[model samples]
Target: MTDVLLGIDQNVDRAVTQAETMLDLFDATDLDANLLHDFVDNPEGASVKQVDSVKRARDILEDAGAAVTLREGSGDPAQSILDMAEQLDVDLICIAGRKRSPAGKALFGSVSQSVILNAERPVLTCGSPGDEA
Candidate 1:
């Protein structure tokens, strides 16, 4: 069985697209997906399961017959995702990449870029719908 750590953010469309991509790439029966959401500024202590994007991704993966596990993290999203990937020892880490200008990325940084550069394992990234190559 191949284990996958899928980082889910606030974009429901991206999350669904990522889920569909995973289903297309691998057989559901052979995949174990860990759906993760990070609450970067949650003074209210939000749960990952409570997030709409995470829930939608979980539903899509689960409906496709993939074994799904919900995970929550607090603080930096990139670090949280990386830590979770290590903790779970997943075969691959999947994340949706946003279309950002170089200046924008430089100013704000990118979680997907950080994960890709620093990960000890393979990372799969897909551009958001309408993103140019």
Candidate 2:
């Protein structure tokens, strides 16, 4: 069965919104929420960290009927998501994207940009929830 792995990032609110939105995009297909824990725990450097909000987000997704998958990773966010995609042979990746201007993004490239650029398989990027104005 073709699996749609929703590559989750640290942003809890975003991840929850993404998962809820993805529920529509992946109706018949099997969907799994692969939450990137180490990324949340160690964004800048390797120091054991814990955040309750992230754990709560994972539980929220699970309660929403999302099959959750957790794993540790150390690298760029784009690389982490891509590695899982390749390893699982995922058909598509559902990620979050911000509606940033070219100049704004040039100053800081978002994870969505990196994933879309390097992913071997097709990527589906959902816009930020806050930008629905």
Candidate 3:
């Protein structure tokens, strides 16, 4: 099975939805998918809502036949994503990218941009309508 890794950010549900949609689109083909939801889950600094959401995302992905795993990082979402891709030796990666303004890009380096620039495999990016900047 060709492994497709969905690199989920702090907001994981959206990534899962997009990846599933892609899977459904290619339903006729043979492909295997999994989701890796990463975050900084410091025992003293994490929010209950965040933890629960990540867990729920994992459960949903697993139910959909993709292995789901939650990994802890030091708040570097991009690094966490790359680490997971390397560990899995994934053939493809799907990540959520919001439309960013020039200002936004200057202020906060775009994670999607970083991934697209660094990924060894193909990276699929989805953006919100308003985020189309």
Candidate 1: C-alpha RMSD after superposition: 1.7
Candidate 2: tens digits of C-alpha lDDT, residues 66-127: 67666656667778888878888877887877678888888877778898999999898776
> What clash pairs does model 2 have?
none
Question: What lDDT does candidate 3 reach at residue 67?
Answer: 48
lDDT of 3 by residue, 78-131 (tens): 777777788889887778887668899999888788888988888888643443
Off by over 4 Å in 3: 25-32, 40-53, 128-133
Please write out the lDDT profile of model 1 over residues 104-124, one tens digit for every residue.
Answer: 899999999999999999999
- Model 3 worst lDDT window (10 residues): 22-31
Q: Model 2 off-target regions past 4 Å?
A: 27-29, 37-57, 131-133
Candidate 1 residues lying further than 4 Å off, grouped into runs, are: 131-133
1 or 3: which has the higher TM-score? 1
